[model samples]
Target: MDARKTIVIGVANGRGAGDPACQDGPEVLRSLKFLADLEQTHAGFSWDDPIRLAPGESSTPLDAVVQIGTQLAERVCSHLRQGNFPLVVGGDHSCAIGTWPGVKRVLGDKVRLGLIWFDAHMDSHTFDSSPSKRIHGMALACLLGIGDRRLADVADAGAKLLAADVCLIGVRSFESAEAALLAKLGARIYFMDEIRRRGLREVFAEALQRVGEHTAGYGISIDLDALDPAEEPGVGSPVAGGLSLGELTEALTQAHGDEKLLALEIVEYNPYRDTHFVTARAIHDLCQSLIP
Candidate 1:
């Protein structure tokens, strides 16, 4: 946040979800000129080459993810080494399998990594726990080093984030196994109900403080579904009661220019589901608010 130019990395992958249409998300946003104006407006804004799966890499979904994820990890790690902030735009939440690991590898072993995940669902499922077996639902688990070996062991051999250094906000949907896993690990989760009672501003500030504890820095990953579908329904998964744009945007501004804020990732932007580009604009504004 020290006025460092932001490097936008687009992850053009959708193999982790049931619908693979979002693999085209980064390209769609690029071609449609959604981000064209940002480059003109901010001197610090520019796009890094989008990450995509090479042909013949898809022997299996798992194989495809591992391939792209490895490439993405290298890309993100290289950017961090250059002292630019990495803003990862995603094809699906599964790109997280690479995002945090890249950040952690750069931070190294002595310092811990902290994350704030804003999503409608817990995104904490494991292959054994998930009924759908969609890897998108298991991103947080993978980031925490408890899912498939390929994902859990992304950068190092173990976890990218400790449960104590992580926080999940806007979680209204989750199954028992993932819930038990997080609960057993003692991760702090401010569910939708709690946010409703205490308010997003307060909750987000507390979450920021929670993740900031005993860590080098923290990052935020937002799933578009975390915003209420009635207000913004462009994501692949929509929840009825979720965060409002006004509140979320205002809350995000509080973190603006915070040097401790390491990286930002916003994912699950299904342009096909959008109603006249409302969600696209949401993505635009969200990034505008937080980028250093």
Candidate 2:
């Protein structure tokens, strides 16, 4: 019955991305010494068994993503039903297709869900629009009721989140189609340029306001690529300029213990690319900031 209890669910399948190395993200993070320290120090925080793809589900990338998303959704829904916070660490950003929908399922149809997506890319491309056709790039579009039907219908039929209730921050890389889609839908985007002008703390506060307005609850989805690649290079797709670790952690703490904040998801970690586990430590710091 303690709402402060957090269940960490690691979606260990990254088949939705062009690179599958990120699939190892969950396992690597689970073994980190800090996790054990967290377990002993915080009685409410614990890692559940990592979720993976079925043995024969590799027929297609979309199929694989859907299967993993479905499993993740069920796990998230179960944890939320128990009044625990769900912290989802992803194999790739494609986890959004599952994570948010699961939160929505727990909130029910009448409750509106909001989300603030932190990423280097817009993640708004559909199969037809994406040149690479990676589903990881299409997550937000699907959640906004725009992309492939299979993704939109994950935890339940229809959009998991509303465009009005959504905001994207730290976007500096995305194709025209995805940009056009978000523009047409009127979703708020605080591009890196704007974040630099306004500061991450200010932009994040505005984003929190935007997503929380009239919504029952909101969740934060952070793609590790949203951090500057020079500083955090262990992501599936690293961008040149992004948020700093110190600034981002400070901004996130603003929502700490905010009851309306439903869940948290951080994705796109590639252990193979990490230099000296710097990014791993960044992940630990991020989780530590928000852990109740």
Q: How close is candidate 1 to the true structure, as a TM-score?
A: 0.97
RMSD of 2: 1.3
Cα-based TM-score, every candidate: 0.97, 0.97
Q: What tens digits encode model 1's per-residue C-alpha lDDT throughout 172-267? A: 988989899999988999899999999999999998898888899999999999999998978978888999999999999888888888889999
Report, for every candidate in turn, its global Cα lDDT versus the true structure: 0.88, 0.90
For candidate 1, give the lDDT.
0.88
Instruction: Give candidate 2's error at residue 105 in angstroms.
Output: 0.6
Return the clash pairs for model 1, or none. none
Worst 10 residues of 1 by lDDT: 55-64
lDDT tens digits, residue span 206-254, model 2: 9999899979999999999999999999999988999999999999999
